[model samples]
Structures are given as structure tokens and as C-alpha cells.
Target: MTSRALDELPSRNPTGAFRATDRADPYWGGMFATGISDGWVSASQHRRATPEQKRWSGVPASFVTDPADALAQMRTNRHRPSILGALGAVASWRTITREQLAAITGSAVMARTYPKSLSAPFSAGLLAHGHVSAGMNRLAPARDRMSMWAVGDQIDAYARYRKSLTFAEHVAVTGGQGWDAEHRFDRHNVLTTELALRVAEYCDVATVLGEKQMALPALLAAAGIEAAQADLGRKPDAGIVRRDGLVIAVETTASVGRGFRGKVAKWAQILQRHPTYELPLVVLVVDASTPSQATSAAAKNTTTAEIQAAIREAVRDYPGTALNRTADRIGMVPWPTWFPAPHEATAGFLDLTASFLARGHGRDEGWRQMRLLDPGEMPYREGTTAAGETIATNARLLAATPHWLRTGTVPRTDQYLVDQASASDIEVLSSPRVPDRMTGPGFTQSVAGRKWRHMIRLDRTHRESAA
Candidate 1:
């Protein structure tokens, strides 16, 4: 970030390294530097190049090795208004001159996301991240946002994502076929690797995120590490091989749903049996939007604390109420992205990781088993908000509402919402309709399965004609 440091970075990528970074990218601001010997290189925002950036940013890439230095750099560089504003503009799918961001400061999150962009051509992926209802009031942390941008790798993923729009109706995406059908987190490879960099800071462990794809066991053996399971299958977010030769599996999730509870319980049983098999899970539920009347000062603490309580309530029944003894191995270290102190709050990731490593190895039989990540140490990557991002989604029909008076049968869904231009209001009515769409509220029970996009009448009128 200083003059001499900039002088040390290569001005040109002589390797023609196939590295990629563009300020125009929407998610994962830029590619994580993999196998790069140097640190990060800033992206150019202007259509034209600046003489200063040309000399400084040499497409810098790095697999973060040192936690303290990497996090501090992220915290310090977060103040660089030029990049911060550029990312906001990119997410909103707008273009602004670097000069505009130069004066930006204070709560750095943009007010609106893809909803306003929902109609925009650029939001084809629908990048509905974090809070869905936050139209013009969405807030993002600078450290988390900027750090994520530094790991941008969205181009190839965009190509495949564009094709998902053409998916046919009535398609059945059983198994994992439907999960990767759309572009969820295109930069997840870089995102996970950045997380490992932070983990490497506290303990001696090799991460699976940044390693080049090779035979799994071969890679682990080469690194002198071992996995508790034969397949360290891409299930866990990140894991490390500690110096003491123990494998600590790390998982972070935005959803505290039943699925998450089951995952925690699986690891809980694993740790309970193995005892020293420490798994630190970081659960960050993005706080709700500020109250319409709440001032910025009040919204900061209140919203985050409320979210924290919601997490506690969700975790209350983990593994079940009867299994309190089994649940003690699983703990929570809450990292609230509390208000103006976003940067400091995120640094908690490092604090939590250090605490776990220092006290683990079958030690604190009862201390908060899974230490919630400190937000500060979270600089290696962004704290996830939502588990899913709609790069491509099953469509919702825009057809006019059927006249129940004439049709005599309502569609077969549990409920349906109709908005009529002639009516003064719109109403979401509960109905006997069935399986309207694959990606909406009724997905779980819709036996028609994923990619099905129509609701039909439950009446025998259509059934008799089949004969």
C-alpha cells in the first residue's frame, strides 16, 4: 500500500498467467491470486488506464499465508474509496468515474441491490444476496465487501450461467444436478481459499481451497496431511491440518435452518466421538433492515443484536432438546456485524480462531464448543449472508388471473397471489392450487419437482379428457 511496496510489484504480467480481474465484475470483485508470489493488484475502474495504476497493479494475486499482515492490509486498504465505490457501482450495474468514489466515506453499503436491478439486463443472474427485501436500504461492510472483490473469478461462471436461462420446463433436477444448474457463488473457489488463508494464520494447517485440482489423496499426502474421512468431500466449507496433526474442519453458513442443524449435529457426533476433532462453525445471519424510524446509531446495535438472538433461538433445539449433553460439543461464537464498527466487528474471526486453537485438542470439554468467528479475522473472505444467490431462477408466470367464476376450479397450490390492475390492491390468497413453480415458496412439496413452472386445476374437468 506504500510507495516502495508498490515499487516492488511487477508492472506487467510477463507470464501471461491467464489471471483475470475486472472492475465491471458483479460478484467476487476480482480473482483471488492463486500461485502468485506477490500480494493483490488493484483493478482499473476507468475505461482508460491511469498512469498510476498501470505502474502499481500488476494483476497481483496471492494465496494468503500470513493472517495478521493480510487482515491488516485488508483493513487499511478498505479506506481506499476508489475501489469501494467502484464495487458498489459494479453491483448496482452502473459505471462511474474513479473521481466520484474518491470523495466517498462513512457507512459504505449501497442502499439498493438487484431488485431495482431486477428489471436491469445486467442482473440476469439476479444477484439477490443477503437480505432480499432490502430494495434501496441494503448495507454492506467495506472490509467484507472489498475483501471479496479482491477474489473475483466470475467470467467463466457467467458463461455457464447464461445457458441456464434456456432450461426447459418440467425438467427434473434430482440429486445435485439442480444445485449447480444456476450460478450460485461463481467465485466460491476463491472465496473458500481466502478463508483458508485466515485459518493458516492461527494454526499450522494446509487448506483445500487454493490447492490446484489433483488426485485428492495424492494432494493430501504431498502436503503431509490427513482427513478424518476418506472423502473430505466438498461438504465442509474449509478445513486445515494442524501442526499437532489433527484435522480441524471449519464450516460457515448463513442459514440456521434445519439443514444447518443436521450438519452441525453430524460434526458434533464426530467431535464427540473423536473429541479432538475440532470443528469451528461460523454462522452469520445478516441483521434485519433498520426500522423506518430508527436512526443510523440505533439501527446498528439493535438490528445486529436482534439477529444474534434469532441465531440463539434457532440453535436452542440443535441435535434436539433431549440431547443437551451431545450439544455441548457444539458452541456458538457470535460475530455481529454491528453498525459503524463493521471493520472491528469482523476482525472477530481471527480472535475466535486463535481462541479455538489455543484451547482445543480435547481441552475445554465445555467452553463454547464451536467458537463463532470474530468478524475482524473474517477479512480473508466475506461473511456469507444467504446460502443461495439466484444466478438463474425458475420463472414465475405473468399470466392474467383465471376467473374462478367461469373455471370453477382454482389452481392446485396451497396459496396464490393475484395483482390486478383494475383492483386497488393486491392480495396473496391461500388456495387449493398445486405446484406452481420449482423455485418459489412451494418447492419443498411440489412433487412435480424442480424446473416445473405451472399450476393446474385440481378439478376433474381436465382429468376426464385424458381418456
Candidate 2:
């Protein structure tokens, strides 16, 4: 890559897929693809993620589906990558150079690559530092000292991700109002977040209608979080609502230090004044190793529980509009999962739900007659069939209604259910969900603002002092 061209890439990749940061980006994918990638987190770590990625990508094969090779070729047994290893891994694929890897990835050892093709032994592509720092030693001094921490490389993984498309175009499909809409998701993090929610197959009528955010009444009912939409003075990052219960406000932050703490403080304040009883606020701290957050101690040094405890303490002292002990009602959680195991989530986890609009039967009466199938609390489980069967069967049985299963009769195929689940930005709605606009405090606006915000219903076991 040209010096200028090489300078433009993002340093890290979206790590949501592996609960990692820039280190796990696609540019680094070549590292994994080259059979020397870190295999600390096995495919089984993301049990639901693999199937979901394959399903939404609409391709049976992708990283998630076929990770055996990468796993087998693991170069290191370290839980996380060493700095030196990362630099080398990226450079091994020409993403960075060996010298650069040595400086940052924690290696002092270095080598020079001579063009065997041309028989030249000179360093050809050594990059001059792009932005010279104020204290940088302008004079090339001979030093053999390595710092405990090194500044991370600024290779934009997103830019590289665009160049390194792996899945088929159909894999990008999402089942929003605009069923077959064009490319709405630009980032893998955004796309995967939506797909994960949808594939868990939680909502029957999950949709993105107009300028509204994503909303899934079915998931709400399943998770038991009251679902509603609201128009705050300013639009929130994301949130899920309840008509008679709590309004869970979810905010995502890729920043740490003041920015991260500020978001938590603000959301905690919102939880205090929120018009619901079970108003638990969740702040999703994105992958911590991004350029903005990687340097912050809160993101790097503090444990997730420690941060949560800090947020809880901070919220405790903040004055509330209606309730006391409001601190207990607010929560600050790590990205990938706000709470503990079995319920890990990204900030998008509750912005709204990603769901497929099941176009029933055919154009004749099919369009007019369609039912939204909910994936229930257990997303991987089979949702109700068109025949009203709760256990998911083959697509052929989609039209099977409640009577068909026990009646031992082949249900009429007229009621076909086609899955159009993928991510999209179009503000459209499935014909059925379009209805009389909901009215009330939060219900005054569209429940979904047509973005991939996540919504989570705090189940009974999870609801704590955060009410």
C-alpha cells in the first residue's frame, strides 16, 4: 500500500462479534485467514452468534459457520493478544510493517525485508511518522528502550472492512419495513448487532417504520419489558418502553474517561426523572480499545463490575424527579452484555429489535393476511408458525395453524411465510404493524425510529434496585 493510502485505515476493527475491539478487525481477518490468528475465543464462545451471522448473511458459510480452520491454526494460547503479536499479525498481511509492529505490538526485535524479486537489500517503504508529536525526538537517536505501553496503530478497520467484503450480498439482507432494501448497514458492528437481535428471532413483527427507531412489541412481551416509544427533549441513543411499567434507556459509548463517565452520569439522571417505575438505564461501553477509549484507565484498568458499582454510586447521589434511592435504579454495563452471562448485549441490544416481516402465502390474500411471529425470550427457539404452531418446523409448515398440527392434515400451503430478516435503514413498515399512532407520554411518537437500536425487557430475575 502507498504511504498515504496506508495511513488512512482505521486502527481497530469492530470487535462486537468477538467482544473485542480494533484488534479483531477484518484487516486482521487476513491474519486469521492466513492460519496464524489468535484462537483464544472459540466459535462456541458465541454459540448463537455463528448461526445468526450465517442466517442473516443468507450464506451458509462465513467466519462464524466455518471457524474450524482458524481455530486449528491458532498461533498463541494467550487469552488476549500481546501487543507485539498484534503488530506482527497485522504486518504479516501487509496491513502494517514489521518495524511498526515492533514499536507498538511489544516487540523490540526487528527485521528488514529485502526484495527477493529484485535482489535489493534496502528498506523500501519505511513510513515517515505522519503527525510528529511535540516531544518526539526529531534527531534519530540510538535507543533500545521500550515503554510498558505503546500507542496503538491508527489503521481504520472500517475502511479496510469495506474493501474486504466476505459474505454474499444476500447475507446483508434484513427484514425491516423495506424488506429487500439496499445496503443500509455500513459497519459490521451495526449490521451484526441488528442481525443478532433478529436471528435470535425474538420479534414476530419487529420493524423499522419511517424515521422511527427499531421497535419490537413481540420482544417486549417476550422479555416482559413494557414496550413504548417516547420523544424526549432530544432523541436518546436508544431505549425500550412499557405502557405501565419501566422505560429502559440504553446509551452506547465508544469513549472513556470524561466522555464515558459523562454519558453514564447523564443517563443516570434520565433514569431518575424517567416517568416509569422500573426505569433501569443501561450504558453500553463499546469495545474499549478504540482510539478514543483505548487510552482511558476506566476502559482498560477498571473491571466492569467496578465501573457498574461506580455508576451505581454516582446515580445514588443524583437528585431525582419523583423517586429516592434512584442510584439503585440506574446501571452502567459493558458493551457485548450489560449484565452477566446468558444476557450479554451491545448497546443496540435494546435500542429496538431487528425482526423479519413474514410475508404470508402469496400476493392474492397473503399480503393481506400475515401474522408477526415472535421468537420469544429464547430467541433461538422456534416461534409460532402461520398455522399457529409454537415449535418451529420446516418452511413448508409455516402455514400450519393450531388445528393443523393435531388434525394430522397437511396444512394448505396458501399461507406461506417467507423470512426477510436483514438489516435496513429504510423507514418503512410491514403492512400489518402500521396502525393508529400510539398516544401517551412516550407513546406519543413512533415506537421505532427505524435504526438498529436495541430493546431489552428486564425479566423478573434481573430487575434489582434498578427499578
Candidate 3:
């Protein structure tokens, strides 16, 4: 961005707001001109002039439409790309919570600065509507995270710039939820979206399908499953589609909660129908320190054992070796945090995941090793090794582990693989657990469900005593 001359300033509106006119200022004037025309600035906001509110009148140092250009201008203006990425990401997701967007982009400042002091960047080819303040005519919920909705009547030309499908056919195939308004922003959806973004960042080569996309008719058809099965609501949290037509289904779960056995059976039904799809199910199990019935180390010795135990006694009376082998596809690891903290703790895990999915040899090696170890153990513990060196060496280590585990010796070139692999036991150790509190609407609903079940049990017991 270059300095603007005295003649280039946007003309002021009748109400003292600045209105952008037809000019070649791609960074500022041209991009924001539509916002003023569309009545983004409300009349009530102009009633008073606070020192903070006056900053909106100041000239922009620079603005850039292209991310590359924004990066180039980072030294002069730090907020350009962050704002650009935030705008595009929010548009792509349709309605993302502030926390979700922040976690996805790893930008705290971006999380805090939208729809309030962000009118300038908010207008970059998108309409800004506050979901929190849309009705009730009051301030947003005091404790709840405020969400912004950027999809309005206007066509979003910036949709192509967002890291999502822009074509009508592609959107239809991969799920058109991105273009629609998201009614519920629950923990499951938030974590799923975060995982998708993280996977997209590290696994740039493969196409990441979000949870909604996983249930799409086109995707299910491609996976050799019927649309009717999807209607029954059996689907993975996300998926990775490769060039070779193999789809690695990714499922994230906090536990083998109630009905997990039936859930696994439903998954098996889907998996049995589609051989091309593999369920590399990942679970967030209780931290060993936390007092729970599922904490035995023996049960968690391998991915299959852990998953089998998670699905638990429900599968015992149910027949078949088929359900038993289904555990082969599931992996369990201690939660890095009590809640999902993918941005802070899961980079290396995702990096190793990318490496495993990048090539045929690596994916094959990962599957072979999954029988013995959890997938989370692949990345060398952070700070013990260089940034990506551990990830690169982990691939070699995966191949060499079998040889060394059997013969107790590896070649000289693969010596480091043994050293790192031997010391990675600490990788599975759990993080400190905080007392679980119901903070968000999602958790509140979960608590209500628990209460409802307790009431039913009490009612049943009272009836039995009377009988």
C-alpha cells in the first residue's frame, strides 16, 4: 500500500460517515465502497463521537485484496493479511465463533477484532451481520462468545479467495453448508471445523472434507455407500480424499459414550459397504490421572484394544468377528487438553499425519504401525527435536520400527529413528485436567440430558419399590 494524496480521501456522507466513491484504490476505497452503499453503518452509531469510534475516520495505511500482496505489505501493515484471512475464513465457514476462527488461524488479535472496531475490514467483499445482536435490542450475551454472520443478500465474490469450494457443482458435491447459515455452533461442530482447518494447513495436498461434507450424497456415492445410509446419520467427522481414490475417514470422539457400540455397528455397516474408505478413528480418552472406569493401561496398550474397550460391553452379546476387527481402524490417545486445543497442542500430530497421507509408502507404513502404537505417538515430543526434523525422521522410524523391534538393531542411517522412537513414550502422557464445568450451550444441553436420564432412573426405581 502506498501513501494517499490529499485529493484521494473518500468523501464524507451527509451523516458524517465517510462514503467510498469510484476510485482505483483496490486496497481501501473500491473494496469498502459497497459496505457504505449497503448500509453497514447504522445511524445510532453516529449519534455520539467517542475517541475510539473516531479511529474509523482515519485513513488506512494500506489494504490489499490478494493474500500474497498482503504478506508483502506485512512489514508496513501487520493487520492486512490477518484481516483478509479472517474475512475470508468467516465467509467460508458462514458463521464461525470468535474462538473457532482464532484457533483455526492461530491469531488471537483476529479473534478479538471483528464487527466492532473492524468495520473497515468487515466490508471487504462481504456483508457483516452480528448473530448475537440480531434481536432482543440489547448487548450480546454477557458470557457467550459473540458470533458474526457475513452472508447476506449480496453475492460474495471473495468466496473464491476463501479456502473452500467456490464452483456450484463442487459446492453441491462437497456439501453446500458453507453458503448457508449455521444455526447451531456446538462443541462437536467447532472441534470438527478446527480439525478440518488444521488438516488443511498441514495436509495441503489432500482435499479435506468437513463433517457436513462427509454426509453429502455425492461424497457417499463416491465412497460406494447409499444416500439412505447417510440419512440414518452414520458418518465420520471428516475425511481426506486422495488422488488414488482412497478416502481416509477421520472420526473424533471424546469417549465411547452411551450407544457407542451401536454407533460402531453403524460405522461397520458403512465401512463394510465401502472398501475404498478406511476409518482411522481417533478418540480422546480420559486422562490416566482422572479417576474413571476406563483408565487401565492394559486396555489402552494398542489402538485396537482401546477402541474395543471404548465400544465396551455392548459388543459382547452382539455376534461376529466383524465388529472385533473394526477396532483395528480406531486409535485412542489421551486428550492433550481437557477440551479440544488443536491449535496449541496438535501441530506435530497433524504434521506427521500429513506425512503419512502424502505418499503411498507412508500411508501403508502408518497402517502397518497402527496395530502396535497410537497414531498420536508418531511425532517426537516437541522441543526435544528441531521443528520438522522429527516429523521427517518419524516416517523413517515407522519403517525401521518393525526391523528394530524384532532384531534389536537398525542400519547406521536409521540410528536416530531408534533413539527418537525409544524416548517417545512420554508423548502419550496426559495434560493436567481441570474440573469439568458446563460453560457453553453445548455442554449445558449435555448436562440437561444427564439430568433427564437420572429422573427416568429414579422414576423406574420408585415404581419397582411400589410393586
1-467 per-residue lDDT for model 3 (tens digits)? 12233223322111211111211111111112111122122222322446565344221223213333322333232343344334434434444445445443344443452423244333332434342332221233433324433433323433543332212212222223444433233333434454444344334223444444455455555435566744455556555443223344555444344565566555555434433222223222222211122244554344334454544332233322443233333333443322122123333333322211111333322323231122243211222223223222221111111111111221222123324444222332112111121212111111111111211112444435534
Per-model TM against the reference: 0.29, 0.27, 0.38
lDDT of each: 0.27, 0.26, 0.33
Q: C-alpha displacement of 78 in model 2, angstroms?
A: 52
- Measured on C-alpha atoms, candidate 1 has an lDDT of 0.27
RMSD of each: 22.1, 24.1, 26.0
Index of the highest-TM-score prediction: 3
Model 3 lDDT on a 0 to 1 scale:
0.33
For model 1, what is the alpha-carbon lDDT of residue 64? 15
Question: Which residue pairs show backbone clashes in model 3?
Answer: none
What's the residue-level lDDT of 347 in candidate 2?
A: 27
**Model 2 lDDT per residue over 375-430, tens place:** 23112122222323221221112110111111222222211111132212122212
Question: Which candidate gets the maximum lDDT versus the true structure?
Answer: 3
Measured with C-alpha atoms, the lDDT of residue 38 in candidate 3 is 23
Worst 10 residues of 1 by lDDT: 397-406
